[model samples]
Target: MVPRPTSLLAWLLSTLAAIVLIGAGLPGPAAAAATTTGVKFVDIPGDGVTLKANVVAPAAAGSYPAVVFPSSWGLNDVEYIAQATSMAAAGYVVVSYTPRGWWASGGEIDTAGPADMADLSKVLDWTLANTPADPARLGTAGVSYGAGISLLGAAFDKRIRAVAMLSGWTDLNYSLYSDQTRHLQSAGLLGLAAQLVGHPSAELTTMLGDFTANRNIATVMEWAKVRSPATYLDRINANAPAVMIANAWGDTFFPPNQLADFYGKLTTPKRLELRPGDHAIAELTGILGLPNDVWTSVRGWFDRYLKSDANGTQPGKVYLKPDNAAAETWSSWGAQTTSTKRYGLGAIRWYDGTGLLGGSPTTGWSKSLPNDLDTVANGGVVLLTNGISAFTGLRPTIWLPFVDRNRAGVWAAERPSTALKVRGIPKVHLNLTGTAANGSLVAYLYDLDSLGNAALLTHAPATWLSGTAGSRTLDVSLSAVNYDVPAGHSLTLVVDTVDPLYYDANSAGTITVAGGSYLDLPVK
Candidate 1:
């Protein structure tokens, strides 16, 4: 059974003991939005130093359902107080806390280590002891770092009645380092955010060093495992808090695949809102006084479980918003699968390829352009343009710019007699012979119109180590997406040597794709 405070007088005394940390110069946790009248900063004595948190309770509250929000990496309570006040207005007590080693907090940052998870438990205990937090109706929520921590905390503490995770990763290894390749762009930006906010912890500094130097990841491999919630699925499943995941469809940082894997492993009550945007845009917009799915779905989740007032909102439903397709909903995850359609890869020319879709197996082959192996500026630039720049803001009020691939090694299928809807990730198989010590290849899927204009649907990257002319077969999984193929349009696969988002060998190599290679798309 979950635990609760039985004595009100003792809890009040603890609340009165709240203190301002000396030399830290931290301000009290007060709500910027005036929706909640009773807002105050409270300090809870923790393992090493005091953990700082802000409490926002209903004005005339006797006992109210409570929700706690942990800051995203390098952020403090200030980042989430706006949402806390909104919860307070809905008659819920909210505790927004800064994790250890962040601004105005104590102890070195552990980045979701045991110390960080322990900080969550401390906030829970303090909430129950000092506020009118409903012992039976408590839940936790956050985005990114805090989102993963909520799952980690729920795994150990059964008291979390419900959970809402936004743009979080289920597997740390896959999200941070996929196929032993680092996601340099996202990780570097996140590390920059950490540095801008506070001094770096030893662990974080080590990770940055290894990534920038392109060193083997063995130095910090074990640390990454412990932080991943996928490492503790058994514990999370046993606790079984009702889960609602609200994430973007185009979030390259924590793509839909990671969320899909975690969602599939659970048997608990659940809901999914797969919107369209990059990593932080949709989520931050919602947090900072804007209307979006993250806050809406989370509040409904808390209402259903913590308040026991669901108002007929259904769980287990999948909400999806495709880029060019109509919005759709699935009854449940089990009902959301699409049929696998195989399309053959055929050589349009010696250096270019076009998709031979809906046809039987062929005995033809396609070879990549040696020109791509050249470092000189050429058509390769068009194939490798990712459309993301350093100036892009974290809070996006619009969709990410579309990728442009005009001159590329493309395998494309012309408009079919019938229309189809792509409902999931696209898989690619490559039977190729290459001559290079080491190399990496990237595959991007696009939906093209009769005019040859196209929008990028999904993309994937792979690294290979070979010396002589050696043959290898690669099965690659592109990004997870939902797109509609209009009757007059076409589906395409663009192959290239490098991407701005990841590290590439940039060395010379000639690759010949054999006849058996194909692109398999999940369509309906």
Candidate 2:
């Protein structure tokens, strides 16, 4: 159980001030306002540093609820003002500040560390002491790195009443190392750039060197072991409510499962909202706009908690937006609804003589010599005017290539009529036997539409079953998706020797894949 801030001494301080101010003939600010007026620049005192912040409040104000938006990436106070303004217009005082040393702030910007956390605490103290904000209603919200800071701050400070974390990571170690193993190619560079342009700290510089040399994974992992929030879950107070939003279709960085794991550990009254979108700041801004279902839910949550609206706030709100169903679509999981579905790899059958897999082998289809390990190359001839060729555009939509001793084989699945709707985790159960010493199997999930277009859903880790083995199941889970398999479209299951995005194949091995192997999909 987590301690409630309302029972803390700080809550008493705010309550006493409210009483004294009322007795002195001063009234609190009005709650209904179209725009915020008073804007003040303030300095927050930190350990050996000062943090700069922009405060927005109503003109006529003695006390009002406050929301804080922490700095993210390299964005400064000016860029955060628009988001702050919107919250301010909703009758809440808004404070957007540059975290640590990002811009015009003292001390170093260490992602989530003692210095950064202390600075955040100082910011809260300054806001409570200097602003007309009702200390009892303090809240924080942000996306990505900013969201990470807010979560960490709220974990330590009881004064923070509520929180909204968007696409944030609870374990940096898992996110940077385990989940995205090839970080040197992506997030590693971005982090290096941030250090070069912002902090210029020696530790950051050394870390950059380690990353560049490929020797930094160990050091980075050590750092993550110390700073990861997953290790500090018990420290998070459960009294304050939280809302976590994750993008199901995000590919830039951070896997959806990582977010799910974080959400599962939160003991607070929490709602997990998963959407389908890229890691675009615009999509987040759209969420803030409350233009549609996405934003509506978020605003409603804040209204109930921050404003203490009379309308009771419902719990356990889960929204899953399906892919390609509509221009913009979503599925809701509320108190009164329950739904579940499954998508799997259709069964495997013999390839007919005519390039079709059926009762007989396809004509002109010859199993070529063993290419690299665990793979076999097969060629087939089909009439150009055949319905199969016409419908498939003369190419296989689903390609499954396996890895064996020194060869690999490409296997393709037939297309479906309607677009397949994939909602949850899709697992591929492959039964393969190696002819050589040892080999590995890789599976890919994709969407093939009616227009002959193919897009990747998510990539899975390569599973090395056995080299001198009999038979084993290669299970790989694709990233969760709400994507629609279009009407007259087909879903694809590709098993290849390599995932170009993750790894390269060393030796293609000769392997036999049983046709009965099935794909188990969890759909909802």
Candidate 3:
């Protein structure tokens, strides 16, 4: 979690004083490099509160376009200083504000609730009234927490004509309670960060408590639905804002699967881009006025919609960057895959306690493992593991010989004759039987080299609460990703009961896996 400020008043005063000095042309190197003229800090009226904000516009601006940026979680109004300055120099009035309950802003943190939506409209009101901004040309953009607010703002306010959401989630339920299991680490990190920097609303506090305790799950799901933008997709389509979504494939907080599903349902002009990095890492440099592909695409998106510049924007295209491969473009998300490959699971072998993966379908053999154990095949640490992989291009790896077959079920495939380009979601189906009434299983897809080293490609988890007496079929869809498997490398599958990334229900039982199981791979 992030550390708290020494004193809220002192921190706020220091930040505002720096902005004032920058406006006066007497600040540090970074501040001096920004657009100096027409920069001012002000307090905008919110929903019965005051919002600390700043405005940057062209010095000789007539009626230029306008953009509003809401700060991310645990950040203040100065979060977008560099991008705001560059947009101001590009003939656009930019207003960046601290959301309520963070830094100097008033009111409790609503967590992108109704109050946050209203606050966004108020920021737009202040922008049109104070700056020389055209009312007809309006846009909103943000990252992570701010990204969710921006998407919801477009649905509430028809004045917003364009939107760019980076590292944001559309389905809150899918993010927190995907496949009927709790995403423990991601939710825990978010709760801690909010408590450190801001005051959570009564509803948010109650929901977090219930979520962690695994009590009143119904109430938790209902509360999350209200905050999810997917619940208001119809309203967004009716308002018809040109939307652009950019996200990283390895984002631990907000995965790309939900965003891809949401992108498929949009009727308005939209674009989707999935790159290789962790949450917000792909756009971090761009926030510093540095050259970045994601930020460049965002600028092009705004130019096309807000300023009607169609020089670089593709309205209905999907862009993807696979690991160790060139970027690819398609007409739509569904067009990325040309075919699907199905593999069968063979009986567990005695040589190395591993089974065949791609032979004919073999049945009548059952393998049982202790349910309350974890194996080496698991998702890495929440933020640090994937964040480091973003720069190193090395994913979490495991050795086949080290995996305890008594705790996990492992399967291996023969070396492929040619390279395989995986472009979409992979799925696994299993016939499971447990001694207790409930259990959980995590399925991992890996790329195995000749030396028995396996690199994790994608994975998913499933939990069952009833009908443990008989065999039950569980279908799980792994995360969406793009990767290339080189020739002579094999594909492997691993099923375990526990992963540190999620909360499992397995305890004091043996989960049995029968035959007639299969895996489906989507290839381009």
lDDT of 2: 0.53
The candidate with the higher TM-score, 1 or 3, is: 3
Model 1, residue pairs in steric clash = 354-412, 355-411, 355-412
State every prediction's TM-score relative to the real structure: 0.84, 0.71, 0.93
Q: Under the 3 Å rule for N, CA and C atoms, how many clashes does model 2 have?
A: 52
Question: Ten residues in a row with the worst lDDT in model 1?
Answer: 375-384
lDDT of each: 0.68, 0.53, 0.83
Q: Model 1 Cα displacement at 160 (Å)?
A: 1.2
Q: Give me the runs in candidate 3 sitting further than 4 Å from their true place.
A: 1-39, 467-469
Tell me the deviation in Å of residue 341 in model 2: 8.1
Candidate 1 lDDT over 171-210, as tens digits, reads 8777766644456556655666566565578888887787
Best by TM-score: 3
lDDT of 3: 0.83
For model 1, what is the error of residue 185's alpha carbon versus the real structure, in angstroms, after optimal superposition? 0.6
Candidate 2: lDDT of 251? 33
Per-residue accuracy of model 2 over 91-210 as CA lDDT, tens digit each: 778887877767687777676677777777787777788777887888877666677777787767888777776656677765554433333223543454365436645675676567
The order of the candidates by TM-score, greatest first, is 3, 1, 2
Lowest lDDT 10-residue stretch of candidate 2: 377-386
